[model samples]
Target: MKFLPIFLDSKAGPILLIGAGDPVRARLRLLLAAGARVRWHATDGDFAVAGLDAVAASRIERLETNPGAADLGAIVAVFCAGAGEIGVTVAARARASGLPVNVMDDPAHSSFIVPAIVDRGDVVVAVGTGGASPVVARRVRERIEALLPARIGDLAALIGRWRKAVHARIPDMPLRRRFWERVVDGPIGASVLAGRSDEAEDSLQAIADPSAYAGASAPGTVEGRVTLVGAGPGDPDLLTIKALRALQDADIVFYDELVSPEILDRARRDAVRIPVGRRVGKPGIGQDAINRLLIDAAKSGQRAVRLKGGDPFIFGRGGEEIEALREAGVACSVIPGITAGLGAAAESELPLTFRHEALRVTFLTAHKARDASSVDWSALTDRKMTVVVYMGTTAANAIRDGLLAAGRSPETPVGVFARATRPDAKSVVGTLDHLPALVREIDGGPAILVIGDVVSHSAPWRNASPTPLFHTFQMAAE
Candidate 1:
């Protein structure tokens, strides 16, 4: 909010420079590299930086100490560095002459501050903290540098060359926008990134004329992409960066019941939201219906996102969705998220795997237990193996019986976390025998069951103070 960002057309004319310091030399190099004619006015003669000779001969000019008002008239901008009292005077004169002035380290005197720039030719990014913190701004620029590809600027230049032609081909504003997006984000962009500029140009032109290149490169027809994104364990923070991008890019998001509202709120504001939430005992749309919807949307060239809570592959019916997409010839990808068990571990500060205690961890869903009688409950009874059950609140009694019948001890420590990582999250600490009775108390909220010796190390157990559970999963008034 402190500074409004604007990219100047520096190549318009010569830029005025007043100083003899090292910083001034660096600024000269940048100005010259950007193809700006820099007219330097310094008390001392030496105007040498690392790559001074690399710049063209006529690009730079060394002038006498004091520049006249006529000299400032020819310059587009002025930068003063380490001129001491002379710097202040020059700043005043530059302002009076109605030119944008930048006095190094003096925000008050300067009309503009040069930001830490990530110069990718046409794809330039500038990070500025309004001269408040240059170091912080530089650090932010570094992070941006990592996220952007090296050839991104080249890719942009490739698109720039075809801009006028594309405009002529697709005149409608919305259609033109869609055409550019598809070309830039699809095969043409990929070709540019891979150093195939010729191929990229061909792709771009092909996209512009779909009828001619319909079979070879149908860039006009963008395929619908389905991303199965995980909305991690009720915490928006736990969502992966890739998942966030998918949400933001989604044209239509088909989310489930377990996904939190906060996570859904991160999606593009104008994106269509369709709730296909399916919970036990709830009258809801089936998986088949959801698959059909996803296929239909994708076929219509819409970017569809199937947003689910936690890791999509882990008992989330994500495989089923992938299979359905494969059968329907729609492209689908998965973005992983922190499941409830891992989220509960962080929230409770309990290690899922301890060296001497629980060494292995297993995640299961009682609701989707295909063969309950044939389930390997006996192997799960091992004390060293921590078992996490999702959607088991409704079948807690059956789970309790199954484990107990498999010779698992009734006194085994069990922890139930409801709405894990959420502000109104609740927990119940008890033994395996207490699970059946405890399940009757918990109501509509999504809950996870962690049954292991590791539960002994959890926060509720360590604190030894639990909100007593009342009938119907309601807490008695304190």
Candidate 2:
């Protein structure tokens, strides 16, 4: 990020404002509303607080001295608008003093850029595009303004007032946080937001044991649990709302190697991230060890998230993890994601099921040749069944041999889609007879193989020219 978003304490000290015109006026009002004392040097010498309140106008100290020589000792920040060359000079001076400065519409001369603000009393949202696009920032601010509750700030103020009491009642840090979470998510916070602060206060005061209200087993102990989140097909946007919330709430995350960095970034900033899943050819912390980690994390009162790529239930070993967590008496829940097969199909426009041509869709894995050989290929030989093979890159030949040997036609269309919904995703399409060759054309694994007549209807299949292998296979069949 070009600029870090921060809420500067406006009451810390006076802000030196140097400028004129509407932009300066707008910034002046913003600073005043934020309760900042302003030392104004209106370059045009019109220091009129025409529309401002008497209280706010009284806070502004109009400076007759040249702003370039003005003492910046007690100033916390500097803002320049319509000051032109003088703004640039003052910006350089502020930077030398190690103070944050902003030259309106000029990021090159500024240490900080003002963001579009969504003000909800105590709850303020700042939307910034790093000075690249103010319009975009404003647009984002509008969306945030719409989503935030009108009285959400009132809820924050209530929490602030009761924070010390809650802390005193629940000394354990985790347990105390839980207490506030319960208040904010439960009826007490709702009452405050619904314009019944008195009722909310009474309800809160009536809670005999805040620890009990916060779901603490003992006076100081907090309950911890595991949330198995499905990170969908390398796309952060594809994550389920619940999955995103789980990530945001997690104290620690044990993520698969296939989970994209973008998806990992969704987790809470302070969350402890550990890679536990196996990579392409490298072994990982074994599943048993991973389970132990999860159990231990929860037993220690930390919210743990097992972030797996794609849908947890779809060949993701989610069932095994669930069983392990259950046996360990750890509370756990799952949030499903868009699996790689479905992601690949959607991206490539490869219909897994088509009316009479492809009726059934079977998802299987062939991580190695032995795995492919052991598969019940006979059952998958039906012309109308679409077979999606996961982790089949290494066992491509084995898959072709097994399917062809089981009377699945070599003429069956197939598409090898790699990286699924990721930006670098690639697809190769041809007859099943050239399945191994098709797999070879892809850049890497974490790819899926779609086998069925319906593959011929995919975008890649239609767009691709017939390869020599496809031509050769067709000739042999002819």
Candidate 3:
């Protein structure tokens, strides 16, 4: 909004430098480094300035007079420094010649201003405060410099080298973008950042020509990988950046019933989506069918993504899928997300593990394991431990009975966070005895049950605020 930022073609022609001062010398170094030819124009016989040694000085062409249209036509931009009245006249001439002109220490009379630059070779970042505050811009540039790895530019250059080859190999734009994304965000990019150019080049070569480099890890070969991604609770905002990348890079995505539509929308538009089962009793597509689909997709050299709600490794049955993929010789990885319980706890302002309050947290799936009585309910009766139950709405009665039978008091405070972190999310606070009643109120759409003393102390369950948003946390009487 302040100033239109553009990278001029320095190689097109020479950049005219008017006057010989400290500013002029600094601009010369930048121009030379950017591969710009410079024509030095000065009235003084001694055209020397500080910092420029014999080598850089000899490269500059000395111009006797102020540059006319012919000279301006041969140059990309003009930099004037400490010329006083003569400098103003030179700036006017450069502007009349239709060349972008910069007058040092005066932005009002200039068409362009030199920015505080963070130069990382091929990757250059320019920060300008519209000539308002150079110090502020320089400070911001320093922060960015610290954030970016020293070898990031090298990584970029490496990718640039393979750009043509990648385009030739992958004709499709979407697939090409995905390939590059994997290269930059995946293991290849990591290798480059860590100064492992050799490994990065090898990986890049393998991707470019799978047939020539058939190592097991070679990406686009007959062998493919399955990335298990957690979509987080119902809110797309809660999804991790890594999870989003996995979806965008996926050739096919197998999602759970609890996975929200918004999260699925983030995946590549052309990606094939298969709905796998996660609903309480609704038997959608079985797990065996899902496993076969993933294995088949990978074996055919297509990247597969298994999108689950909350943390996949939590109650999402990710271990089972991992085991199946491993058995079929398919390479796989997991990208963890904010689980339903954690997201719910945050939204409700409930601390799962508070000092001197709740010392430990436990996550348990309400859906009984193959052996119905396998769960050690007694172990979960610790007063200091907070218990979060996933998919527990349907098994509310069963959960209450088990906890009560395990000698846990019926007066134990419990909170139900339904559709946690979503805009339309709701929560209920009540005693263990009221668990089944609270379950009845919920529509059974991805809920997490939190039990412990912490539940009563949370913002949502305590004194409800007058705002409609807080009304969702409907409290039941003792």
Candidate 4:
């Protein structure tokens, strides 16, 4: 490192400002704020002691003529703000006397340079290019000021107050770090950032005792279990706190085919991730084999988490897995996440139920609902009934024929939501007569097709900035 940067504890000794100039006044004020006893030895009266009368302790005259052997004991730092001969003389004597000294506008002569400091009450950020460029340093400080809120210092102060108590209670390293990370970066952090001191204290006290927060969330016994958690749609912002906590505590994660990488990034760092994926028209691991894997992992006492995309309960076959775990006498639980149909509907601004137009909503899986007894086709065929189908893309023709044969109108408006809730979520809209072809045209993954007269009530995006909500068509969804 070319520049030796250190924060002087100004409270330790006196700050000696040797010249009266613009630089001298600024440095003097900073030292005063830092609780330093400042004294000036300048002969000039232009930049006088008008403002420093009360703040500065003394402004005495130095009687020692030759500074090469001057008594310079009992000093923290010295600043020479003069331009030519005096600046060089003061810096030389101070450096020779083993004192940290700075000469203004001359890097070669100085042992220390004053820095651009951002003081946030408890938090201080010092920016120094070591006299390379002060203008650039100030500009960088202004940008940092914009990104940081005023309450961050208050938050830091609160942590300082509670650190002793927290340290006394938490002796384990990993658990303490996890607790602090949640308190400082999770909802509690947001509460403190909004400047509610009472709320901050309440949250801090709640998590200070590890057992108080870890009972329900943390693993109690060495006997391992798997939690099947849904990662929600593409947006990480949409993930529930339960899902996030599960990811935090996971030892190993076995993820699904369709789960987004953004969601997986939230998992614990030490946790190993294995892709137990299934792709379209591909031979993947069978359900029985996956169940055996989970059972085997649990039998060996490993915390295995089976993570899936969207609501695991919806079309994820999570029930069958749970049943299989029960049969094998293994412990397991499920946390439902935001389903794709609901996420897409909300983003697309489509009302699943309207006043007498579409009074009932049905969510049916095309692949699963097609087995044994078919879906309540008669009820689904009602004009007032809205139907959301998953895994319906490949069986679009079969589904269209079934709905029409069950007495649905050919003119019933329908929409197919492709890759719902993602950045590039696409939708195909047309009457029921034209839906199969419309579904075929769009080849995106995991499409949710909505059927009923209510589909005409669904909003359309104009592919513009800040897409308007719930518009029929530019001509009609106005």
- Which candidate number has the best TM-score? 2
Per-prediction backbone clash count: 1, 0, 0, 2
How high is the lDDT of residue 475 in model 3? 27
For candidate 3, write residues 105-160 as lDDT tens digits: 88977999989999898899999999999999999999999999899899889989
What digit string (tens of lDDT, one per residue) describes model 2 on residues 1-478?
Answer: 6778889999999999999998899999999999999999999999876788799988999998898877889999999999989999999999999999999999999988899998889888888999999999989988888888899999999888888987887788777877888899899989988999999999988999999988888887878999999998887888999998899888899999899998999999989999998876787888899899999999999999999999999999999999999999999999999999999898777888999898899999999999999999999999999999999999999999999999999888888888888777778888899998888788677888899999888887766665424321110110
Candidate 4 stretches with Cα past 4 Å from truth are 1-221, 368-376, 461-478
Clashing pairs in 1: 441-473
| TM-score versus the correct structure, for each prediction | 0.60, 0.95, 0.58, 0.56
Listing every candidate in turn, what is its Cα RMSD in Å to the true structure after a full C-alpha superposition?
A: 8.0, 4.2, 9.0, 10.9
For model 2, the stretches where C-alpha displacement exceeds 4 angstroms are: 466-478
lDDT, residue 246, model 2: 90
Candidate 2, pairs of clashing residues = none
The model with the greater TM-score, 1 or 2, is 2
TM-score of candidate 2 on Cα atoms, chains taken together: 0.95
Candidate 1 worst ten-residue window by lDDT: 469-478
Q: By descending TM-score, how would the candidates be arranged?
A: 2, 1, 3, 4
Judging by lDDT against the true structure, name the best candidate.
Answer: 2
> Alpha carbon lDDT of residue 421, candidate 2?
82
* Residue 405 of model 1, lDDT score: 92
lDDT (0 to 1) per candidate: 0.79, 0.88, 0.79, 0.74
